[model samples]
Target: MFNTYRLIGAAAALALSTTTLAAVSPQDAAKLGSSLTPFGAEKAGNAAGTIPAWTGGITQPPAAYKTAGQQHPDPFADDKPLFTITKANLAQYQANLTPGQIALFKSYPDTYQMPIYPSRRSGSAPQWVYDNTLKNASSAQLLDGGNGFADAYGGIPFPIPQSGVEALWNHIARYRGSYIVRRASEVAVQRNGAFSLVTSQQEALFKFYDPKGSYADLNNVMFYYLSFAKSPARLAGGAVLVHETLDQVKEPRQAWAYSAGQRRVRRAPNLAYDTPISAADGLRTADDTDMINGSPDRYDWKLLGKKEIYIPYNNYKVSAPGVKYDDLLKVGHLNPALTRNELHRVWVVEGTLKSTARHIYSKRTLFLDEDSWQAAVVDQYDGRGELWRVSLAYLKNFYELPTTWSALDVFHDLQARRYHVQNLDSEESSTVDFSQAIPDDGYFKPAALRRRGTR
Candidate 1:
């Protein structure tokens, strides 16, 4: 028995030691301001002048913009498309396009088109965030075989990533605003171009970005999120509260659901992985909420280096309050007229499911914006190695917070000929409120959910 116990302890030690080596060298970390941006993006542009060098990103809101809830005016509203990519001209720009993007033209030759705009490196975070990222570069380490992170706080955890999992960790730990309240609508568009809106009110407090928070105070949690369905009588009053943890392997994500019909709040452990999102009408999985979420333990990740691609960027026009939902939603895809695609460098990472793992997607390829570490595009494949779904995030600079994040996330189902769009606030009375105060710790407790739900 003593010998068996010794063997088990040794195995555990080996696993921990393996993940501790995921840190980059201090010499590479020192390049943040010299050869790399503070967030670790290449400071210099490509040899061609098409993509310009990164000056400091747009840090201030436009003079016309008053407060957080108002619609943000596009800084580059006057700029027109440099060129358009259609089925006729796609081959000319095929080198910079993803396979899924190329397939879109083939699937909808007449309706789908990409308007290529001049690249804008408009993503930026607060000065404190930049400082934290520099610190995290040499300190953060992957824990539990890429399931979590350690020795990091208040920044992109792996700015100078040495592994694909580290790149993913950077996305998972990217800086969003400290706290925000949002009113948005979601739709699962049918093949026939018909859809019903599912409106929701959501709140999030990113403890990782809390000005006063430290690694010790996080309690292994990254953020606190609560979402409530506000429209459609059947789903109204239903709410979900989640405590997203930093070290999920040690303390798994704590989630609770309040059912209006049942008038009760219950533990919701199945909110991760391949579980279908209820509000999405079975169009997206829970893990697909933020393009990539939950644990990275189920797959082997490979870093494919960086490449220039036409990705959705500076998409303020699409999220403008004046643009009604009707004009944005088309039969096959979002109205090309409202979308903006730009040429930018993105880090590519691929994940293949492990033999011991279980997931609907057998493999996934992720393209992360170098400026913001946000997953901009994702291509998911099925067990048979067939492309199943393509996900895109339309990102814009939230100038008030001085941060760049997704204004809208769209998932395209290739086989079903349908799609799901989330985070539409065009018709809402109010958009995002970033000045909201953080709630007390007790507010997110399961018991508190019952009280809030009953009300």
Candidate 2:
């Protein structure tokens, strides 16, 4: 275990000295798709063999899947847990767990547990994405002291990341198809397990991943998003539009909110940073939407290297068709029986709040899955440096698009003994539709919000 840590640390140190904020050398870039996975993950498995080597992740949908809009069936439904981790035996597995994972075991000694399944590196992107990632290895670079990146689009930027900021940028730019539409619900489960659903119709067009677009065409815009609230009288008819800029320092995120009550559209600058997500009932912040989003300027990032940890992965059962939300959302956490945990190598990045910068989370430690470039787990600290919240992204491959994305994101507030969940659409008419045609930018503007809002 120490050897693995040392090797990863040494590699990171070398990259820092050689690459800095610039693209890696041709020799190092050649390592990608050879010794390293196309996305820059180690191609070889660990010595223990618990984690297998990556062999071109899920290239096609499972036999169980019938069509594009149907709920994704579990590809590994026959697999069973090798063992389970609980508070009683937590010490034995403590080394493989994060601070937040350990805290959860302590928070719910009897109820909270992790069912360990065999590691399956089922993360893949389209051939075009892989091609772009290889090209980005020697061209993509950070801009303005790591506030943003340049000369990279349509693939993982900084695949051979030398710094924490670069690794975070990879997650922000990870492919999720060009356009998608879904009707999902968010809920803040109270201490007693009761919750109210705040549902929305969400649409996003990933300008960074547009096939016909180029880095110059992006003009600093990462993506365009529009969300219209639909549910329980109060939130119904409200809408939000966001133009997520790639270089937030160059041009801050442009956002607009439309009120059904006031029947007016207004600029919403507070939608970024630590502003409370009203739909989350104060349990989550705007930055916590996709585990962590928005600018990383408020924090000083440090690359802590890599570690083999048990994280939530390939969790299809949690969002399986016909699975009611009540059956999945328990008191302290999601139903452990439905979730799957696997041991996998992950890059650890620590973000410490800059002394001059202000945010609710004083510190954050992110565990990014090597195969997917997704932050699988995040431990957030409060002003006093206490473990305040734990965030988990239950990931699964959308084989149709062949991209890995979170099925559901859960944020656990240890002090409040409550949790908030996003992207729960099991009962909806359809799952995420990646085949949706990309809409024009006009559809995501402030004027469109008022036109789309339906009270």
Stretches of candidate 1 exceeding 4 Å from the true structure: 1-17
Residue 203 of candidate 1: its Cα lDDT?
89
Across 346-428, the per-residue lDDT of candidate 2 in tens digits comes to 98888989899999999999999999899999999999999999999999999999999999999999999999999999988
For 1-455, candidate 1 gives per-residue lDDT tens digits of 01011121222222222565445788989999789888999888877877878888897998979876888889999989999999999889878877778877887899899998988899888999999888888888888777788888999888877677888888888988888899899999999989999888898888988999898899888999998899988889899999998877788888999998999888999898889997787879988889999888888887767778889999988888778998999997999999999998888888889899999999999989999999999999999999988899999999998888998999998888889999998777667889877888787787887788888
Give the TM-scores of the predictions, in the order they appear.
0.95, 0.97
Model 1 compared with the native: what TM-score? 0.95
Candidate 1 weakest lDDT stretch, 10 residues? 1-10
**Model 2: C-alpha RMSD to truth?**
1.9
